[model samples]
Target: ISIIYISSNHIAAASEQLSTTSQQVSQGASEQASSSEEISASMEQMVANIQNNTESAKQAEAIAFKSVEGIRKGYDSTTYALNSMKKIAEKVSIIGDIAFQTNILALNAAVEAARAGEHGKGFAVVAAEVRKLAERSRLAAEEIDRITHDGVKIADEAGRLLSEIVPEIEKTARLVQEIAAASMEQNAGADQINSAIQQLNQITQQNVAASEEMASGAEELNSQAQQLIDIVSFFNIGERETLKTLSNLRNDTRKIAQKTTTPNTEFWKSKRTKSKPKPAEGIDIKLSSNSDDTNYERF
Candidate 1:
C-alpha cells in the first residue's frame, strides 16, 4: 500500500508536469492562432485594396477611352465642316462667273440700244447698274474663298493634333490596363496568403486539442494510481485468488513509472511482469481488476 501511495504521488507529479506542459502548449497555440488570424485578416484586407485599386484603374481607363473617342469625333466633325466650307466657296465662285458673263451681255445690249437714239439712253443706264452689281458679287466671292482656305488650313492642323492625341491616349490606356492586371495578380497572391494563414490556424487548433488530450490522460492516470493505493489496504492477507493479479498490476505500474524516468523504452514493456513479485511494503496486495486481461494504460 505504501508503494502504491508512492506510485500515486509519482503519478500526480507526472500529471502536474503534463498539465503544465499542456497549458504551455495550449497557450502557445492560442497565441499562434491569434497571430495567424491577424495575418489572415491583413491579407484579406490587402486583397480588397488590390481589388478596389484595380477597379479604380479600370474606371480611369474607361474615362480615358471616352475622352479619346470624343476627340476623334471632334476631329471628324471639323474635317466635315472644312469640306462643306470648300464646297460653298466653289458655289460662290460659280455664281461670280455667271454674273461676269451676264455683265458682258448687258454691255453688248447697251451698245446696240444706244444706236437707236432716246431708247438707247435708258437701256445704257440699266446696263451700267447690272455691271456694278456683278463687280460687288465678284468681290464677295473672292473674300469667301479666302476665308474658306484659311478655315481649311486651321481644320487640317486641328485634325493632325487630334491624330497625335488619340495614339498617346491609347498608350496611356494600355498602361492603365497593365496596372490593373498587376493589381489583380496582387489580389490573387493576397488571397493565397490568407488561405495559408487559415490552414496554419487550423493546425494550431489541432495542436491545442492534442495537448489537452495528453494533459487529460495524465490526470486520469494520476487518479487511478490513487485509487489503487486505497484498494491495496483491502488485501492485507494477500488472498490467493488476487495475489497473481495484484503482483502483475504492481509490475505494470512499476514499469510505467520507469518509463516516465527512462527514454527510448517501449510502453508495451509495461504489460509484462516477473514470475513472482513481492507485495509493496506494509500492505497486502488486492486486485480491483485483473492485470492479465485488462491493460490499464490502454485507457
Candidate 2:
C-alpha cells in the first residue's frame, strides 16, 4: 500500500510536469508557426518585388536595343549625307573652274574686238557685258563652293560624332542586357526562397499539430494519474480499516485469553488467518478493478 501510494504520487507529479512541458511545447510550436507564416509572407513580397525588377530590367534592355538601332540608323544617314555633301562640293568646284574659263574666254574676245577697230566697238561692248556676266558667275560659284565646303565639314563632324555615339549606345545596350539577366537570376532565387519559406511554414504547422496532440496526451495522462491517486486513496482507506480490524481482534483475543483456560494462540492464529483471506480477496478485487480502469484509460 505504501509503495502504491508513493508510485501514485510520483505518477501524478510526473503527469503534471509533463502537462506543463507539453503546454510550453505547444505554445512554442504555435509561435514558430506564426513566425514561419510571417516569413513566408515576407518572402512572397520579396519575390514579387524581384519579379517587378526583372520586368523593369527587361523593358530597359528593350529600350536600350531600340536606342542602339536608332543610333545606328542615324549614323548611317549621317554618313550618306556627308557623302552627298562631298559630291555637291565637287560639283561646285567644277562650276567654279568652268566660270573661271569662261571669264578668260570673255577677256580674249574683248581684246580681239579692240583690234578690229570701229566695227568691233559694238562687239567690244558685247564682250564687256559677257565679261561682267562671267565675273558674276565666278563670284556666285565661289560663294557656293565656300558654303559647300562648310557643309561638308559640318557633315563630317556630325558623322564622326554619330560614329562615336554608336559604340557607346551598343555598350549601354549590352550592359542593360546583363542587368536584365542578373535581375532574372535574382527573381528566380527569390522564388526559390519563397518556396522554401512556404515549405518551412508547412513544417511548422505540422509541428504545431504534433505539439497539440502531445498536450492532449499529457492532459489525458494527468486525468489517469488523478484516477490512480483516487484508487490509492481507497487503498489507504482499506489499509486503515484493516489496521482497525486487527486492533479489535487483538482486544478480543485478550478478552478470550482471560476467559479461557486453554492457550489463546490457536484462536488468535485462526482469526488472523480468516481475516487475512477476506482483506486479500477485497484487495484483489480492488486491484482488478483498478487494472481494468487503467486498461480502459490506456485504450
Candidate 3:
C-alpha cells in the first residue's frame, strides 16, 4: 500500500507537470499571435499613410500640369502681341513716308511763290507748318519702330524662357506621377501586410482560447488526481500474504460474530481488539463484508 501510494503520488505529480507544460505552450502561442497582430496593425497604418501620400503627389502633379498650360497660353498670347506690334510699326512707317512726300511738294510750291515776293509770303508760312508736321510724323514713326523692336526682343526672350520652363515643369509632373505610383504600390503592399497580421491576430485568439482550455484540463486533472489520492488512502497491501491473512481473519471473525443473530458495534469492537494488529500501515480487508467492502486505518 505504501509503495502503491508513492507510485500514485508520482503519477499525479507527473500528470500535473504534463498539464502545466501543455498550458504553457498554449499561452506562448497566444502571446506570439498577439505580437503578430500588433505588427500587422502597425503595417496597416503605414499603408494608410502611403495612400494619403500618393493622393497628395497626384494632386501636386495636376497642379504642375495646370501651371504649365497657363504658361504656354501666356507665351502664345505674347507672340500674337509681338506680331500685331510689327504690323502697326509697318503702317506707321508708311504714313511717315507719305507725309514727307507731301511736305516736299509744299516746299517746292513755297519756293516758286517766294519769287513773287509779298504774294508768296502766306504760302511760304503754310509750307513751313507742313514741313514741321511731316518732321513730327517721321519722329513718331521712328519712336514706334524703336518701341516695336524692343518689344519683340523682350517677347522673344520671354517665349524662350517659357519654352525651357515648360519642359522642366513637365519633368516635375512626370516625377510626381511616378512618386504617386510608387506610393500606391507601397500602400498596396502595406494593405497585404495588414491583412496577414489580422490573420495572425485571429490565430492568436484561437491559441489563447486553446490555452484556456488546456489550463482548465490541467485543473480537472489535478482534481482527478486528488480524488485518486483520496481513494488510494483507504487501501493497504504492504505484502501479498498480508492481504490473504487479513482476508481469512476477517471471514472467520464475521462468521463468529454472525452466529449471534443480532450483530452490534460493541461485539465487533471486542473481536477487533482481541486480534493482533496487522501492521503499522494496516491491511486491505474489512472485518465485515457484504457487497460493498471498505477498509480504513487511522495513522
Model 3 score (lDDT): 0.77
- True-vs-predicted CA distance for residue 232, candidate 2, Å: 1.5
* TM-scores, one per candidate: 0.60, 0.74, 0.70
* Local error of candidate 2 at residue 53 (angstroms): 1.8
Each model's lDDT comes to 0.76, 0.79, 0.77
Worst 10 residues of 3 by lDDT: 290-299
Q: Is candidate 2 or candidate 3 better by lDDT?
A: 2
Model 2 spans with C-alpha error above 4 angstroms: 235-299
Question: Which TM-score value belongs to model 3?
Answer: 0.70
Model 3, 1-299: lDDT tens digits are: 44455566777897788788878888788779778877877887788789889889989989998988998898898888878877877887788788789778878978987997998898888888888888887788888878887887888788789888888998998899899889988888888778878887887888788877877787787777777777766653445745555576678778776756655776677578757665653454433444234344331
Query: What is candidate 1's lDDT per residue for 1-299, written digit by digit as tens?
Result: 44455566677787778878887888888788888888888888888888999899989889888888898899889889878877887887898798789779878878877897896888888888888887887788788878887887888788789888889998998898889888888888888888888899899889888887887887777677666655543444344534555676778678678777655444444434343445663343444564432333332
Cα error of candidate 2 at position 279, Å: 15
Candidate 1 RMSD to the real structure: 10.2
Q: Which has the greatest lDDT?
A: 2
RMSD of 2: 12.8
Off by over 4 Å in 3: 1-7, 26-30, 96-106, 236-299
Worst 10 residues of 1 by lDDT: 290-299
